[model samples]
Target chain A: MTAEEWEDFRKGHPKAASLKTVPLPFPELCATLFDGNAATGNPSQCLKLQHSAVIRIQTSRTLEEPKEDNMAKFSIATVFIASISLLLTLTHSFSLENPTDRRILVLVDDLALKSSHSIFFSSLQARGFELDFKLSDDPKIALQRYGQHLYDGLILFSPSTERFGGSLDVAAILDFVDSGKDLIVAADANASDLIRNIAAECGIDFDEDPSAVVIDHGSYAVSETEGDHTLIAADDFIQSDVLLGSTKIEAPVLFKGIGHSLNPANSLVLKVLSGSPSAYSANPKSKLSSPPSLSGSSISLVSVVQARNNARIVFSGSLDLFSNKFFKSTVQKAGSSHKFAKSGNQQFATEISKWVFHERGHLKAVNVRHHRVGETDEPAIYRINDDLEYLVEIYEWSGSNWEPYVANDVQVQFYMMSPYVLKTMSNNKKGLYLASFKVPDVYGVFQFKVEYQRLGYTSLSLAKQIPVRPFRHNEYERFIPTAFPYYGASFSTMAGFLIFSFVYLYSK
Target chain B: MGRSPTTKDDAQALFQSLRSAYAATPTNLKIIDLYVVFAVSTAVIQVVYMAIVGSFPFNSFLSGVLSCVGTAVLAVCLRIQVNKENKEFKDLPPERAFADFVLCNLVLHLVIMNFLG
Candidate 1:
């Protein structure tokens, strides 16, 4: 009987039939036998057995009669399911093209803040981030599960929390950043010591006084009731199109919070937004008793740090900058005549978030290659004064896909002790950068180096070592036309010697 | 001021004395002097050529001019040593001096040929 008929008969009379009564179909029998032999000591031996069983099944199928259409449909359905599952597993892993953080954990002081900051959270969600919200003091809160990090980014919004619950602590957060994850911390007036320590670790120091808030008299926002001049309308943003987006911020950002200064010794931290020259950080409720510790343009309202491992962190002095209320608030600078219907808080926060999440300004270089002119194969060592071409393809990760990274200032250096040849590479509109130059006359070990460090983008440093050799003895040109006069002079001297010898001997 | 002869008369007298003195030299020494003059004139011609046409092939220019100058210097040394009246080289034979000059010329020409390119 055909395999299909046997399968139907066995299903219809399961109680009457036994394994001894009927021989099973080849595939089903092999599957059962392989499962019975699962206790094999070596995994490789078990695999061999399974492979042999599959081959036996194929041969048995050829010997048996043809099956019904239902059997083909069943096998096709199983294959389709298996391929879909394989595809799903492949997409779960991290990929180079989509480098933006996927999952983020947001810690807040209370669950009510979730609703208060729903706008920012929704923006992140709209950009395909899976945000996990939890209270800072929750006992079950953990940054990691088992041995793996549960999230690719972290958001600390609980500025007032003195301590965290569970195993989470300052060291744990630093370790998270050390592993190249991103972070965003927002602080306000009376920021807890714990939050201050975190900011200090990132090379920023908040004002010493707990009551100190940023006070800007010259650029304060005009309000219905004039209070402590603490409601700052700050337009002094860092002039970077990559960090702040291409569109100019039309209205001043409304900031009402404390201010901090970047550490002088730390080069990684940068102030994204600064206070006006007249601004100072002091307690506005009390009279001015002494000069404020952080004042003027040095008082940074928003700062960012890019670690050596390329982990990004954004520190904002005020959590209200990201609040729904400030996002909807209208404002006018005290000295300016234009009254913007809405503050620039929404655009500013969104753009900065985009930078911290690595949706912009992430660059990667690939396919670095060098070869002699008019040749396709790369030589082991280059001859001195040989003409060669160097090429590299650079692409920027644009959140969802890798796009061509085009810039005019990228340069390649042929370096040994110092730069022998530094050439600015020309690029095709599609992101292939190339430079052609003759090797220097001197021969030594050399390196092809591209050290690209722009303002907002992650640094791209690539160096490839190559040796350069002097020309061989036979490689020199023999009969040069320019040297004909010298040859003639040398040969004429020899001729003159012969003639002089003959004359001197004959005359004597 | 001291009633010195005119510049033209002085030049003529100097040339006459030099010619008479050179006439006393040996014939072989005179031949060496002629060879020296030829080498020096060739060197001068090459310098003038290098000036008009730029010295682009600098090694060639150097080799050409140096070879001629070297030949002239060697010939002059041979002439000084072979002069029979010179007491300083009375111990050295003229045949030996000529052999030394020939050997030095060969070495100079070999180096010049290598450097010409």
Candidate 2:
């Protein structure tokens, strides 16, 4: 009936005292408390009392008397409760549940940057990221507290701070990166040695001359005053649509920063924006001293590293590259007359920020499964030369909702000491990647390895250990037709032996 | 290279002389010779068969050929021991030699059966 009548009926019952005092011991009874109709709010108070009255009788009869009528009702109630929770979990599973970066700690050299770079900061905020801005020398600053990382990503815009304030240091930041946390580092003309060391650890070498800035005489942006040619209109960007969004950046970006060179030994690091062929890194104020160490297109203005653990980091030579001034500026290259209303700085910064924060180009492989061709369940060990199929669901986090990652380049390796079978997997365009191959004839412990490292996407390295065994004694074929002659020959020799012995012994 | 007909004549003369000399061979020795030839021919047949077919069942091939060759070798040893002309094994009793031959044949056949797979 109504909640008031249900409550009154429960209180009027003779066993109402025990029902009120006794706790709901079984989980089945506990579920009634949640049936407060989650769709509508707080009527569950009276609704719980009403539902519990029915559940109480069901439990009492089943525990003591075992009546069929109440047992049936109790069973139906259990099904209802299970469906409710199943629906809850099903909806949760469909939500964006991947490793998209959420919390970030932004360390700034000065408080003025918070206002100067508010446009870029607001964009990050609008994208549902929680940014924690603090001065570099804040004594209480910490990347971690009590062995728990405070943020999923770190932004170091404090290039001039010689040393980080509290527990944040070179080793702590590197450890954060090693733990698969993302980072963003921006350095400028006055970049301290501490900032250089941090960049060096990430396989980059900034210009040794502290005062040097990238000077491109050929493509310097035309300003109101003819300033030094350090402010270049650089249009050289990496040709990855995934790294830089699919929309081509037409206008050259205004860049005023020092340049760095990526170490050749580090394959993980790549230059996102490089200087035009005529650009060089040298002190704009001083006369030409021994040809500039970093010159031409080799000078990297912006670089990104995807570490082995898939921790992405963006290293820009200019902090102003992320400032509102550059994002709002109109630009014209010196020689050419084509001027744009806005620079490409904002688009570049936003897309790179998305990359660094794992919004775009993040890949995850799930449900790695392998079984025999005819079977559905995975076996503990495989016999040598068994034809089997391997399947994995690979979905790229499309900077958005989880959609199917359709690519033909993914490969699976049946690896022992070396790869025995390396096959490119076929996909269904709906995220299911599969390959069928025969187990190697040789038997040993082997691994199903997927090492996917593409240019812009986060690499997916997965290995599942599987053991291969040679055939058991009875598993071998009992009678082969080709060996029949051998069997015949052997038997004939035995018969000959018998006859020869008989003739030899009975000769006398 | 041009002496084909003359070589055939020479081979026929060699065969004639050998048959004349072997005619005086003891009857029991002739029986042993027949048994040895049987085993040797069986082994040769198996080798030819293996050449035609691939050696896929290698263990079976080895066991088959070895059993026949081994029986022929043992039969020859028995013949030498029992022969009156073979002075090398003269002191070896024919009974002991025959017993040795039977035992060796049993062991060889056992091994062949085990490897026949």
Clashes of each: 0, 1
Given the true complex, what DockQ would model 2 score?
Answer: 0.56
Q: After superposition, how far is residue B95 of candidate 1 from its true place, in Å?
A: 5.7
| Model 2: residues with Cα > 4 Å off, grouped in runs | A1-97, B1-17, B87-91
lDDT, residue B3, candidate 2: 100
TM-score of chain A for each candidate?
A: 0.78, 0.79
The C-alpha RMSD of each candidate to the native structure, in angstroms, is: 11.6, 13.1
Residue A496 alpha-carbon offset, candidate 1, angstroms: 1.0
Question: lDDT of each model, Cα atoms only?
Answer: 0.88, 0.89
Q: Residue B91 of model 2: what lDDT? A: 90
